[model samples]
Target chain A: MSTIIDGLSLGSIYALIALGYTMVYGIAKMLNFAHGDIIMIGAYALFTMMNLTGSPIVAIITAIVVCTLLGIVIEKVAYKPLRGASPLAVLITAIGVSYLLQSVAQIIYGAKARPVTLFSLGTVKFGEVTLSLSALVTLIVCAVIMVGLTLFVKCTKIGRAMVAVSEDKAAAQLMGVNVNNIISITFAIGSCLAAFAAVFYLLQISATSPTLGSMPGIKAFTAAVIGGIGSIPGAMIGGILLGLIEKLCQSVTALSPYTTAIEFGILILILLVKPTGLLGRKRREKV
Target chain B: MSYMLETNNLGISFGGLKAVQDVNLKIEKNCLYGLIGPNGAGKTTLFNMLTGVYKPTTGSFSLDGENLTGLSQETINHKGIARTFQNIRLFNNMSVIRNVLVGLHNQPDFKCNPFVSMIHAKRHYENESNMRNRAKELLRIFDLEEERNNLACNLPYGKQRKLEIARALATNPKLLLLDEPAAGMNPQETAELMDTIRFIRDEFDLTVLLIEHDMSLVSGICDEITVLNFGTVLDHGSTRSVLANPEVIKAYLGD
Candidate 1:
């Protein structure tokens, strides 16, 4: 029971981050390799803001704003000019941007892990089962965000525009949708999610470092691939499933060290069975 | 002296090949105009330039006397030009109603801010319900209201074509471009589509320009026609006269 609760908390963090990946990929049709770096930047911003202001609310708001601006700037500066370029070229540029952000952070903050005070709600005991309040809070937050996102996409005009842009960019343009504006908005939303994920992540790990985002970033991406890269619900399911598997493995002493390998092995097995991921749509060429 | 849409020597070239050149067009407002030609006669190319899909290397075009040359596709669309592809390009994954809602996205009447939508404000709910109602009306006109919740890809071939037009009309375009809308339909479907086209033109008070290979459809509906051959205008006049032209017949029939 304890392991399941821990898994849910960890999975919520991965799900939050994976949404950023899936959304950008769905709308822009580009793998934003710099997305993980955006989370790192968010963490750093949170650390700096918390040190300066010492208020959790203010720190979160500042981190979100900073990451949002960074996301828009990165898109306009690094990704905009390469809009119609080949996937390989865009992929390379995204990787380059990721490294550039990491290097810039190293220069500004130095190569060190900064400790952050974890936000906790203590614990709640239900008879023999003890639930950490932070874990419960994370689960609730994740569920709320997922439901909110789903409703937003289904019920809103801009959300419909996002769906249109994702399915057929030219057709959407013909309908007078400013494709560039929509892309920028997508990036903004994605980075904002990354910031939120950063807050929850810091609450758990209690540290901030330049390379800290890479591990979870790769793991969330793996989760996205497992669920389906462009699918929203897929990310949620994949994240929770991965977290559960990882926690269960950690509970076994012999399998704990091999958890990452096991996660990747499952990914490979999934790819072999379903190349489009679990929830991915198979593209059929119209005659 | 003014036309709804006019092109002054509009042309484009790819490397050494002139896909279209030295073409001038004068399209009157609220009129059904036909552009017909053989395969590779630059018919689609002209449509492409008109809709700002491809920038012309030479000359200029205007809509309602406002110069709009060399603009982007989105800009042209905003300027009241909406088009359908030769190949149907509906938002295949979205529901039928959602496809039209996307077309209604930029309309001032249905505008709602992202923040307002996120919070589900009263105004947002009101605007959304209005938009959905409008989209449903469009679907009803195209006889697609029954499939409002069905994915666009699941619609039948003829219904898919109608849905595309319905989606375009939802944008409230002053000028509508149809590219071989009846390409894969049967005779009965094509006949029904012709009536729908004429009805929409009269009902919406729209000026329409279409490229077609179906002579029956063209002769049955087009008021004026322009025939092109080898990247240049071969004949231009009333439909009856242009269709009677020996040169126009030769260009099409290879006589």
Candidate 2:
């Protein structure tokens, strides 16, 4: 039961972050390799703000704003120029942007891990099971965000425009959707989610570093692929499943050491079975 | 005299090949004008230019005396021009109703207020229900209300074509551009489409420009027609006269 609670909290964090990856890929059709780095940037921003203000909410909001702005800036400066370019070229540019962000952070904060003062928001107990305060809070936040996001995507006009743009950019343009604005908005939303994920994520780990986002970022991306890269719900499902599997593996002494390898091995097996991933739509080419 | 849409010396080149050159058009308001040409005659290219999908190497166009020469597609759309594609580029994965909703979404009134919407505020629900009502009304007109929940890809081809036009109408366009709308339809469907086009024009009170290969449909439906061969206008006049012209006949059928 403890492992399940741990898995749910960790999985929600991954799910939140994976949503960024899936949304960027879905709408812009770019890998956005720098998405992970945004988490690190958010962490640093939150840490600095929290240290100065001693308010978690203010820090989280500031971090989210910073990440959103950075995401938009990076998209305008780096990705916009390469629109309609080859996937390889875009991929290379994304990797470059990722490195550039890491280098900038390294120069500013150095390589040492920064400690974050974790606050016990409150714990939840159900019968014999007791979950950490942070974990319960993280789960609640994730639930609210997920429900809100789903509603936003389904009920809002801009959200419908996003769907149209993702389906057929030219057609969407003909419908008077400002494709550039939509693209910028996609990045902003993704980055904002990343920042929110960072707050909950670092809460669990209680540390922030230049490289803090790397492991979780890769795992979330793996979650995205496992669920079906372009499907929003898929990312959430994949993240939770991955977290549960990893936690379960850790509980078993025999499999604990090889958890990462085992997780990746599952990815390989999944790819071999379904190239488009579980919920991924088969890309149809019009002749 | 003023025109709803006017183009002069509209031309484009790809490397050394002049795909379309020295094209001129003066489309009157609310006119059902047909643009007919042989395959590769740059009919679609002209549509692309007019819609801002491709920028002309040399030329300018105006809609209601407002210059639209260098505007983006979205801007052109905002300027009240909407179009359907040659290959029918409906959002296939989206439901029929959702497809129309996307078109209805561009209204300034429907602009997102994330904070209100996130909380499912009264205003958000009001705007959403209004948009839904409007989209459903459009579907009803296209006889697609019954299939509102079905994926666009699952719709029959004829229904898909109608849905495309229906979606275009949701944009509330002043000018409608239909590219090869009747291309794959059978004789019955083509005849039905001819009536539908006429009905839409009369009901919507809009100007229309269409590219088509069906001579009978063009002659039967269009008030005026322009004939093109090798990207240059061969003739332009009333549909009856253009179709009867020697050059237009030769363009369609070799001498």
B184-244 per-residue lDDT for model 1 (tens digits): 9888888998999998999898999999998889999999999888899998989999999
Q: Which predicted model would earn the best lDDT? A: 1
Q: What is the fnat value (0 to 1) for candidate 2? A: 0.84
lDDT of 2 by residue, A1-287 (tens): 87887788889889998999999999999999899899999999988988999998888889999999999999999999999999899999999999999989989988899988646566678898887878777888998898888877887877888889999999999888899999999999999999988898888888888888888899999999999998999899888878888888898999999999988898889989998878888998877
Give lDDT per model, in order: 0.91, 0.89
lDDT of 1 by residue, A229-265 (tens): 9999999988898888898899999999999999999
Q: TM-score for every candidate vs. truth? A: 0.98, 0.97
Give the DockQ of candidate 2: 0.83
Candidate 1 ranges beyond 4 A from true positions? none
Q: What lDDT score goes with residue A237 in model 1?
A: 89
